[model samples]
Target: MSFNNLKSSIGQALQGLSESVSQKTQEMASTWPAYAQVQQRLAQEKLGQITDISQMPREYIDLEDRIDNLQNSIQVLLHVTRVYEEPAYDWPYSTQESVQDWSRAIGSRVQELSRASSASEAGNLLKSPVGPENGPRTLNYALSQASLAVSTLTSSNMPGPNGEGLSSGLIAYSDTQAKLAQIRIAQDTQVQTKFNKQLREILNNPIAKANKYRKDVQYKRVLYDIARTNLQNARPEKEASLRVEMETLEDQFAQITEEATIVMQETLSNTHLLKNVAELAEIQKNYYKQSLELMNDLMPVFNTAKGDDEDFEIDAKKDPLAAKKVVDDDE
Candidate 1:
């Protein structure tokens, strides 16, 4: 039989024993009323019988064990568990639409700057401001024009172009140099010289010259940072152009550093290039355009002018004789 059926049978047998004991105790109390000792003894016997009935479940110990095993198996099944990891791209961890929007906006700004650079280079846009309000007007119009021009390119391609353009800022072109100079004047000079004088004075009261130098350096740091940011956000084609500009800037930086090193050789025996330590270091940098040009074309024009200049100088000493011969020949 099943464990449950066995347990039920034991319980029913115990109940029947209890009822029989109670009925016998009642009969003895009624029939042997006169004998107090007999009545007391019968009550004691009934108590023992009830205790035995309660303990009768122990007689079916194997059935109890079977019941326990069934219970344990059910508990084991309940204890078994399954776990799973939630998605990583859930609300708090996932990227937002705003991030993409800002990236696009920054890309658009870079495209605008590239167009402006191209327009200025092509002589389509005027270089200098015509009036006090002209700067903003020109900038806005140039940005609008750039948007119109770059509208053909899809949105997905924007980041790639931007990264490539920023890479190109490593190029050093003449136009980039001009723009960098302009950026310095427009952004750096005023803040360092006029705005931060009180701070400089507080920092070093007696060293006016040193204070001014520190302030200038700090200002340049800010301007270079902005330039680097602009280049980083620029488009790939523009980045290529920027690469040319970067080279030019590097050459200029090298020349300046060389001069500085010569001047401060005694004071700074190990003087290195300032551009290396300068803030937004990659921003004010450029690629070697002449080297690139040389790779593309090997012509006499690219030859060293030193020997030719020397030959010209030597021939210049015989100019009087040559001129006399020319006059005689003409006659």
Candidate 2:
């Protein structure tokens, strides 16, 4: 037999053994006093089998990899399952529905994370598993009552523009939805804070500073998508103002681009919160230069005006034609 056949055979045998042990443990937990000891012995035996199997040299590297991957997955599942694995337990009636629903949500999230992780592990499953085909059936157990969650927290209907009142369940659902939105915002803020810090450090090196400046500019383009989404979701109360905030952020991005031109200068080491502080420093240098030029140009005009005033007063005191002569000379 090929090594893949052997590994598959081994995997099948291990799976069967695991199920047998689990069944026996469940049965003995209620029927036998030494059930814990029995479970421990089974686990130790399985561990020994796994250790021995891993020591063998095999030609089917892919099969070996899959076997190892499945083993690790099984271990993780076992660890997760352990949380609910009390030897012999009875379900309480009062909070059973809530508990069931919470478990369903957790299971759904786990499945999502699992599929995502698996796709990442093997590179084939790029499409989101939550799409139309298998989504409703596979994810039904994890569904949440959004409207109910919202009403539960606020004890009031979320006001719509039409002035229609929603039920308590809907209010609970809305409350939960708002919480989720806030959580997403918090996560974004946390990520942006890290990016800002990293950009600060990157600005310490001139080349890195330039690279990060370009990166920051490029990355901010993503904000357009985010802004569009936010705009789509924005309620009538806040949509206009929210758009303005997004616009301001975009304007800041543009200002940063304009400032980036200053990085051509030699001194580029000192840095700050913006992505390209050295470039901003150059912007400041240019701003100062323009201000100096303006003053230089204005200074002569002011001085001449003042001098002309003095000459007018002297000419008025002595000869009127003297003031005209001064004006003609200036022209």
Candidate 3:
């Protein structure tokens, strides 16, 4: 071919390729909003599964009950490690010794708070605000209620995220921060702060704190009485063995609870991230040009499809042709 002719052909080919790319780009731009919607919906659904932390879990309840059952029985061991109680009968005990070990256990939890982890832990806490066993309430309701609960504890020093109280204010992101910052705020600032503010105040109060001490003393006396009677009714070796078992169990519970709490904290943090990821998707949605006609809440309607066991099986008895398609009535 001549030089000019060849050059003209190449130019035409380039033009056609550019046009194809432009058309493909336009197609993607038109449909990308659906991508954002799916992301938002999935994130919201997962955030809904974030563990409810506001009312504590049944596992914690069971642990607390177990502790209560122990009472003053081993008040000496509450804060002490096995090192202190080793060799079984080594430690001295007295009814007058008294008991109140919540200080150490709760303090350990507080100390473990990695602002990042705790926020995530707390973020999932409000996933359910109605009864414990239900689908999620709205994110707005869960967060607003958390703010309100925190507000009840606001003081001049701890006036919440802003200097205003939690109930009266919202701790919103003015501008989206880095992922790490978001996690920190959710766990440490929001959830952990609220729990600590309430818990610490009670722990500090003279009268309120006294009640725990009183409860401890009462339980201790009962334990002391039991031990005394056991000395009379049972062998010294068996009584000693029982004390060893109780001490071991208490230590095990504390260790397990601590680890479990860390898992809960991480879940809570991720839950917050889940919601934020959804919200971020919504923000991205604004980037797309969605017409008024395209805007609707279709997710709820889509969830109505269901199947019973019978629905899975072929119902050929009702209609012979229902499950079978005859291309032609051949033979």
In model 3, the number of clashes is 11
* Predicted candidate 3 versus true structure: per-residue lDDT over 79-188, tens digit per residue: 33222122212213311121222445444445545443666675554342322212112232334344545545553445433334222332221111122223322333
Worst 10 contiguous positions by lDDT, candidate 3: 291-300
Ranking by TM-score: 3, 2, 1
Candidate 2 lDDT over residue span 112-170, tens digit each = 66766554653443343422211111111122234454434434333542212234334
Counting only residues 3 or more apart in sequence or on different chains, how many pairs clash (N, Cα, C under 3 Å) in candidate 1?
Answer: 30
Candidate No. with top lDDT = 2
Models sorted by lDDT, best on top: 2, 3, 1
lDDT scores of the candidates, listed in order: 0.38, 0.44, 0.39
TM-score for candidate 1, residues paired by index: 0.15
Looking at candidate 2, the ten consecutive residues that score lowest on lDDT are 132-141
Stretches of candidate 2 off by over 4 Å are 1-204, 264-331
Candidate 1 ranges with C-alpha deviation above 4 Å = 1-206, 244-331
Model 3 CA deviation exceeding 4 Å by range: 1-235, 273-277, 280-288, 293-331
Give the true-structure RMSD of model 2: 35.9
The true-versus-predicted C-alpha distance at residue 140 of model 2, in Å, is 78
TM-score of candidate 3 versus the correct structure, residues matched by position = 0.18
